[model samples]
Target: MKIIRSRSFTPSRAWGALEIANMNGITTRLHWTDQPYKWHVNDGEEVFAVLDGRVEMRYREDGIERSTVLETGDVFYASVGTEHVAHPLGAARVLVVETQGSV
Candidate 1:
């Protein structure tokens, strides 16, 4: 059993993550970031849950760019081939679950 105190976690660099679990080819991670992640599509799906601070989640739909603010406790679900990026408002902690090795 394990318990992670995400509020006290920080990485030496931006967007670094703490691996929480890996099972059945899926991985769960806790990420700390202040910078924006590059836009990309995942191989399968992803669940991004904000645990602290806020984030502006940008994505493309029907070839048009769109975005939404995800405050703490907000969850964003990205399906397969969903092109998206995450821009944190400040230092934020996010829990992400997705296929292992997916980008």
Candidate 2:
């Protein structure tokens, strides 16, 4: 068993992540970032949870661009083929769950 303090976690570089678990091809991770990620589609479903700070989540829906602000404790769900990206308001900690090796 292990206890993780998400708020205190820090990454060596922007968008760096720490693997937490891998079960049945699904992976869970803790990520730290201060920069925005590039727009891309996940090969599978994803659950993104904000642990600290804030984030502006951008996505394309029906070919229209949209965005929403996610604060600490907010969660975002991205389904397969959903084009999206995350832009941290500053330094933030996030918990992400998705298929192993997915991009």
Candidate 3:
């Protein structure tokens, strides 16, 4: 059980890069900045909490374009194996918590 304050978090320079916090079974990461990117297939569930600013999650699957914009205090839950890319609207910051699943 650890506590992370806002003032203690350092901002990121680029978009794809992530700042990780608790990396036990539950991994916490922070995202700052915006750029075009893609998330490859993975085997873990991801949870995102919008700490400050605005962010957007974009993806296209099955010939469909999907996007979700998150503001301050917003949260999103992504299942395992789901592929998507994240973009910040304006120097946004988001907290991501990843959990591993059994095989």
Please give the lDDT score for candidate 3: 0.66
Across residues 1-103, which tens digit of lDDT does each residue of candidate 1 receive? Answer: 7899999999999889999899999999999999999999998999999999999999999999999999999999999988999999989999999999999
Query: If scored against the real structure, what TM-score would every candidate get?
Result: 0.98, 0.97, 0.71
lDDT (Cα, 0-100) at 41 in candidate 2: 93
Q: Give residue 42's lDDT in candidate 3 (0 to 100).
A: 49
Q: What local lDDT score does residue 100 receive in model 1, on the 0 to 100 scale?
A: 97
TM-score of 3: 0.71
Scored against the true structure, residue 53 in model 3 reaches a CA lDDT of 77
Q: lDDT of each model, Cα atoms only?
A: 0.96, 0.94, 0.66
lDDT of candidate 3 over 75-98, digit per residue (tens): 877777567777778666677777
| Arranged by lDDT, best first | 1, 2, 3
Off by over 4 Å in 3: 1-3, 15-24, 61-63, 100-103
Worst-scoring 10-residue span by lDDT in model 2 = 1-10
Model 2 misplaced stretches (Cα beyond 4 Å): none
Clashes of each: 0, 0, 0
Candidate 1 to truth, TM: 0.98
